[model samples]
Target: MTQIVILAAGMGSRLGRSLPKPLTELADGRTIMQQQFDNIRFAFGSNAQVTIVVGYKLEHIIEAFPEASFVYNEQYDQTNTSKSLMRALQASAPGGVLWMNGDVVFDPMALERAAALVAREQSFVSVNTAKVSDEEVKYTTTAEGYIKELSKAVVGGHGEAVGINYVSRDDKATLLRQLKRVGDQDYFERGIELAIEEDGLRFEPVDISDLYAVEIDFAEDLERANLFV
Candidate 1:
């Protein structure tokens, strides 16, 4: 079974809203997390385990997704995506896992490609080279196409990471181990960087540059994301 973990524990203070990021209504009238679930079901079918990590206003998410499994992150106020992701990863079933940021809205095709990669037992990070931004997490790959670095500071990098990735069954343990090295204040990608550099965890870049995707972190981002609808 392939598990899908969504990190949605953080309060969207940057968005300047009282609503939790995942529960924020998109232009389509559905919440961001609902769109994610719809896309995931389209790509991977209905059988895959979809687990969400919730904290701030967790009840809203529970109400929104009554049937979905959830892992509570009690330290959401004190931690970042890394900690929320660790909780989700720990709760995931034993097998390949697809990890996504709950506040992001991406084209179904992008997730379909990610699911295909995971079905092949490949661990990969989705990237969009078409649009690169300084504020978004970026990735740099070696000439051979293996990820070398992943961080927001990687200016002039190959592409922006789309906040979606897959960890094969064989690599799940290694990824969890690497995630343990990440600090509470850091993004989960930091653990991926460490895994790539220190443990040689192979996370190839899957270019989905042509696909439409947006991380709704701010008002401007929400405006741009509306274009997708």
Candidate 2:
């Protein structure tokens, strides 16, 4: 069975909305998380085990998706993606977990591209090399094209990580261990970077540049995302 996770624990304070960011509605009238659910079910089937990590205004998410499995992040305000992702990993079954940030608006094909890696049990980070912004999480690859440096702090970055990734069942333990070592505010990318640095974990960057992926950080981002919808 395929395992999928949606990290929806952050407060999304920047969006300036009363509801969770994932609950924000788009032009098509589908909430962000609803569209995400449709995309996941479209690509992975109705049988895929989907677990959502919810925190800020979690009741909104829980009430919206009653069929999904959920894990609460009590420290959601205090921690970051690393901790939210770690919780999902710890609660997941024995297999690769395909995960994404809750606020990313993208084509369903993005998930399918990541699904290819999951089916092969290979770890990967979905990336868009077309535009690498300084504020986004960027990456630099090794000689083998596996990820070398991944974070917002990288200097000469190759591309932006589009917030979708998978960790093979084989590498789950190592990545989880590394996540525990990162600071509370670090993104999950930091853990992946550490895994590559300390454990030699190989992560392929699947190019999704042809697709639309806008992570809604501000109102302008939401506007850009709605353009694709």
Candidate 3:
């Protein structure tokens, strides 16, 4: 069974309100985090053991996904994703796992593509490439489709990361160790770069252009996520 980790432990201060970012509303009358959890639940079924890392307003998240295993990151406000994910990765124990950001909104097709790659035992990323406008998030790539760099900028002409990652058991272990090496200053993205450089873990970028993925950080993005519902 593939263990999926959803990192929802952040305090979204930039959202400019007290409500936890994940618990924010969508057009479908479900919270953003709830919608994502429901989608994942559908994709993986009971075999899909989900571990959600929560910190800010943790109780609300707990009540929302009672079936999911929970790991609280006490330092969620002080730390970055590298640390939170490192902690969640620890509690997850030994296994092949998929890491996803709690904030991204997308259709099940993206999850399907990720599952396909995992079924093949490959390390890959789901990305949006065809909509390579200036506003799109960036993911640098190699000729063979491996991501060489990733960010909102330097996004090559064709690919942008969709905030979903498939990891094998070995890769997961390696990533955890790298996470330990990352200082308190780093975020998850830094760990990804380190994994690629230090461990030769080339994340294969799987293009899913037709699918839309909205990452809600600010109020405007939250409003944008409404379109998906």
Candidate 4:
């Protein structure tokens, strides 16, 4: 069974939404979170265990996805993805967790690629090599082509880490340790970078750029993503 987590605790003020960002309705008539759930069910089948970390307007998400397990992040307003992810991992069972930023809108094939990686028990950061936005989470690989630097501040980045990622069962403990070590305001990538630097965690950059994957942060991004939907 694949253990999946969605970080949906932020207010997503950038998107100007009164509701949770994951609940944003797309052109296809399904909300972003619903599409993510459907994509997971498609790739991982019925046994996939999904947990959502929620805070900002959590009630709407709970009402929409009542069957999903939830972990509340009371400090969501003060922290970032690192802390929200920490909460999920703390409550998780002994297994690798496949997780994504709640706002990503991607082709279903993306999760199929993710599912394949999970089956191999490979730790990875799903990447889109086609676009390397300076403002997005960028990554540079080691000589062995494993992820070396991963953050928005990366220099000469080869591509962007598209936010779909996994921690293998073996690396789970190490990642959790680093996540705890990260500051409250740091994104989860900081924890991964620390794990790689301090404990030598290997995270492969799985390229899924041929397939469409958009992280909805603004109205323009949502508009572009809707074209794929």
Candidate 5:
């Protein structure tokens, strides 16, 4: 069983919208959450357990995704993405977990490629090596191709980490423990970096450079996403 966790707790104030980011309507007329669900089902099958982490107008998410499991981050305003992700991970069952950010819209084939690696019992971070942007979460790889450093501060790195990753059941406990040790203000990637550094959690880099994926953080990103859709 592969559990899917979506972090949707942020207010997305950068988008200049009152509605929660996940509920924002895409150019296709489907909500961002709906598009994610559809893409997940298409790539991973309908039986995959989808758990959404909601806050900042959680009622809208609940009403929209009644069939899916949910974990509420009551302190959404006070915390960052790390807290919302931790809540979802704590609520997940024992299995491979596919974690994604709610504001991202990606090609389904990119997920399929990542899922295939997960099926091989390998945890990985999705990256688009074709282009690296300063605004995105950049990453650097070791000589052996393992993620050596992952952060926005990395300059001229291999590529930007698309906000999607897979953690195997075997590595879940270690990753969760690392996540718990981090401060609430940190991004979940901080925990992931710690897990790699301390616990020897090896995350292979899955390059989906040819695929289309966009993280809708600002108005321009939303415009790009609309063009992609």
Candidate 6:
């Protein structure tokens, strides 16, 4: 079974408000995290099990998703997603894990495809072959399709990370140890880069043409995510 881990710990200072990013209102009355969870559950089928890594107003998250198992990161404000992921891994049972940023909103098919891809390949990330946009966070890829470099700036690539990742059990241990070795990095992508360099844990690109997801960063993205609803 594929375990889904939703990372929702950030305080969303970029949103320019005191509100938690995940609880930001959408057009349909559901918060962004709730929308993400609903879509993931639908894609994973009724029997799907989920783990939510929460901080930055964890009480609200706990109250909102009473059924979800939670892993708290007290230093969420001081650390980055990579550290939150490492801590969450401690509580997680070993298996293939489909990890998504909680602030990302997408159609159910994207999550379904991610699960399918991980089950087939060792591990993969949902991405796109479209031309890079100014708003896109990009990565550099080798001819063999393994990620050679990653950057928030523009670069040559057939794909862009869509924030949905599938990690296999074998790669999980390797990646986690790499993250630990590179402790206290400001960004999770940094840990990913280290893992790729040190342990050869490359993220395969799974084209997300027929499916879509948007990572909510600013208020504009919060407005944009409502369109999918």
State each model's CA lDDT, in order.
0.87, 0.93, 0.79, 0.94, 0.88, 0.75
Q: Write the per-residue lDDT of candidate 5 for residues 47-68, one digit (tens) a residue.
A: 7899999889999899999989
> Which of 2 and 3 is the better model by lDDT?
2
- TM-score, candidate 4, is 0.99
lDDT of 4 by residue, 1-229 (tens): 7899999999999999899999999999999999999999889889999999999989999999988999999998999999999999999999999999999999899999888788899999999999888799999999999999999999999999989999999999999999999999999999999999999999999999899999999999999999999
Per-residue lDDT of model 3, residues 1-229, tens digit only = 7788888988888887686788888888988878877778777766788899899999988988898899888988888888988988888867677888888877877887778888877877778766665755567777776877765556345666777887677688877888889877566766776798788887788887788788887878878878778
- What digit string (tens of lDDT, one per residue) describes model 6 on residues 1-229? 5577888888888887666777877899988888878887777765667788888988888888888888888888888888888877777897767778888888878877776666675677677766567566567776788776554664665557788777787788877776566556445666677778777887777778666677888778877777778
What lDDT does candidate 1 reach at residue 49? 85
What TM-score does model 5 achieve against the real structure? 0.97
Alpha-carbon runs more than 4 Å astray in model 2: none
Model 5 Cα RMSD, Å? 1.1
**Tens-digit lDDT track for model 2 on 1-229?**
8899999999999999999999999999999888898889889887798899999999999999999999998999999999999999999989889999999989998888777788899999999999888899999999988999999998889989999899999999999999999999999999999999999999999999999988999999999999988
Q: In candidate 6, residue 96 scores what lDDT? A: 67
Candidate 1 C-alpha lDDT tens digits along 118-164: 87999999999997788889999877889999999886788899999
C-alpha TM-scores of all predictions: 0.96, 0.99, 0.91, 0.99, 0.97, 0.90
Going through the candidates in the order shown, the clash numbers are 0, 0, 0, 0, 0, 0
**Alpha carbon deviation, residue 76, candidate 4 (Å):** 0.6
Residue 128 shift from truth in candidate 6, angstroms: 2.6
After superposition, which runs of candidate 3 have C-alpha atoms over 4 Å from their true positions?
Answer: 131-137, 152-158
lDDT of 3: 0.79
Off by over 4 Å in 6: 131-136, 183-185
In model 1, the Cα lDDT at residue 92 comes to 79
